[model samples]
Target: MRLLVTGANGQLGHAIDAALEAKDAPAAYVDCVVDWVDLPDLDISSASAVDAWFVAHEPYDVVVNCAAFTNVDGCEADFAAAFSANALGPMNLARACATGDAALVHVSTDYVFPGTEPGERLETDVPAPISAYGRSKLAGEGLALAANHRTHVVRTAWLYGEGKNFVRTMLRIGEGRDEVTVVDDQLGNPTSAADLAHEILRIALTDDYGVWHCTNEGICSWADLAEAAYEIAGVNCRVRRCSSADWKRMNPQSADRPAFSALKNGHLESTIGNQMRPWREALEDYLR
Candidate 1:
């Protein structure tokens, strides 16, 4: 099976590559070739270029799009660039997948939800993105679904692991700051990229096609997440409880952020099954 992975340099993409390189992991990838395409090698923003590459290389089994314009604030600052990469990129790939008869695994975010105070956002929740980044991702979801290709979209959030993420950011800040303040009100699950990669493999290996949510079990606020990071990293920094407004004061948030955007996994729980451990467990393992 020939698989093409976009955004090869990202945290999720890098985790997939790491699993492929592991000796004890699934050998299906041994016979299966994973084409890791980064920028310059492949740019999702160019439709013609994407079409040409797909036609030339012809990904046999699937195209895993791990690429996206992830910076929330940056997206608000430059909506065009965000749409070009997030929305148009998936649009082009979905079209290619449709033409080539290949399955697609598209990564989405919890930000697509309104993040209002409520129960965990079910898969059926209406998407009301608050930020430009969320809007772009929602657009990608629309394009992928509209393409009508045999595709899967996995929505996750608060991701970390071997990459610059919230946890890492907290640990880094703790290195100097005696006290750190994080958002205490906003709630979301902290997903590890490694676990998300494994979940992606579960979907890919089974060829199950649909939208799924694969976040780490349980939920917490940014302040809670920061405290955990400090405890795990053996850092003795005081993490004060604060609101989003506090953090956004200096590092002004680019896009509107979800206040409560936890994703429930009724589908993944019943269908392909979930191997993702609790957020705390995944966090500990990632730190190790």
Candidate 2:
């Protein structure tokens, strides 16, 4: 199979490459041809560029898009740029894939849901995004699904691996600090990018085309995640749990986040059997 991975330098992209190279990687990838591209190599937001690239690299069996405008606060600052990258980018890829007869697997986030409802969200649940980043992602999901029948929109949460992320930030901050403050009101799963990448590959192999939630099992607040990371990494740091409002008070320009945006892998569980491990277990593995 000929595979194309966009945003090739990001955390999930790196993890996908690692997954394909792992000793126990799936047999399906043994004979796969993969192409990694990002930024200057390809601007997915441009429709003409995407079409030309598809024509040049014809017969792509599958295209996995990890590219996204992930800066939440920045999205609020520049919604147009965010929409262009997060929404228009997927639309362009989906259009090209529709014409080329290639399967499109687009990575999304749990922020698409309004966190006011306190429960694990299912794929069937309606998405009412409250923030700019969330709105852009939600739009991307709809656009991709509408533009291509063979599209899989996988939603994940609190991801970390092979790049700058919350866990890495905590580790860096805790190195010289006795205590660090984190938001306790916000709740979601802390997913390992490696685990998510493995599942993405599994999802791409099947014909299950629709919305899917794939995150490490279990949920926790940001403070809880920081404390867990400290404990696992043997860091001497105390977690001062505070509400989201407190966080906003400190960082006035920060974007609003969901209070409870944990996602349930309902589709994955029913279809291919959810393989994502618990958040703490995944975090331990990631840290180690």
Candidate 3:
């Protein structure tokens, strides 16, 4: 199987690369040949460009779309660009995959839910996105699934890796500040991109395809995650937990987010029988 990975420079992409490398398995062993692609080399938003690249390259058995416009606040200001990247891009890939008779695996977010309730969300839960970013991703998920019968949608949350993410930001800010305040009301699982990448590869190898929620096995608030990061980094900064409203007042430009968007990986666990590590353990590995 020849696999195509989009957004090769991003966090999850890097993790995928690392995971593949660590496997150290040849195409014969895994029956796979991986091809990485990203912006400048290929613009997923442009349908023509996406088609042309697929035509020029070798036929891929699986296409995992990791590219997306993730800026929550920016999506509000530039809805068209956000929709083009988050929604249309996946549609284009889905069309290409359909034409080539290839399977598609789309990386989605927990933002797809309104997230007002206080419990783990199942794969069967209906989506009612509250923000522009969430709506765009939901559109992408719908298009991708409808465009191809062999499509797998994986919804994840609070992702971090070797890139600019919440953990990295907190560590950076802690370096200069003696005390940092984070929102305690917003709760979700903090996932490791590396772990998610590995799971994506496993899904791609399988014939079964559908929507699944994959994240670290536990949940926490922003303040709790921040405090954990500082603790792991051996930083001496004091962490102050604040309500969502207080956080908004402090950072007026902050974007609206779900209060409780944690997801349950019941489908994935049942299908693969591979348990995801706890969020705290993943965080420790990432920090180290």
Best-to-worst TM-score order: 2, 3, 1
Candidate 2 structure quality by residue, lDDT tens digits, 156-266: 999999998999999999999999999998999999999999999999999989999999999999999999999999999999999998899999999999999999999
Prediction 2 TM-score vs. true: 0.99
Candidate 2: worst-modelled 10 consecutive residues by lDDT: 22-31
Off by over 4 Å in 3: 24-31
Give candidates' CA RMSD values in order.
1.6, 0.8, 1.6
Global Cα lDDT for candidate 1: 0.85
Greater TM-score among 2 and 3 belongs to 2
lDDT of 2: 0.95
lDDT of 1 by residue, 1-288 (tens): 899999989999998887766675566677787788979889988999989898788466878899998988899999999999999998888888888888888999999998986889878778999889999999998898788458888899988866778888888889998998778989999998988887787687666677788899998998899999889989999988977777677576446688999989867888867777899998888887
**Backbone-clash count (model 3):** 0
Instruction: List, residue by residue over 199-278, the lDDT tens digit for candidate 3.
Output: 88777767787899999998899999999999999998999888988877887777789999999998887888656899
Q: How many steric overlaps are in each model, in order? A: 1, 0, 0
How displaced is residue 171 in candidate 2, in Å? 0.4
Q: Given candidate 2, what's the lDDT at residue 79?
A: 98
Model 3 CA lDDT for position 98: 92
lDDT, residue 9, model 1: 91
Q: Candidate 1, which segments miss by more than 4 Å at Cα? A: 23-27
Task: Please identify which of the two predictions, 1 or 3, would achieve the higher TM-score against the true structure.
Answer: 3
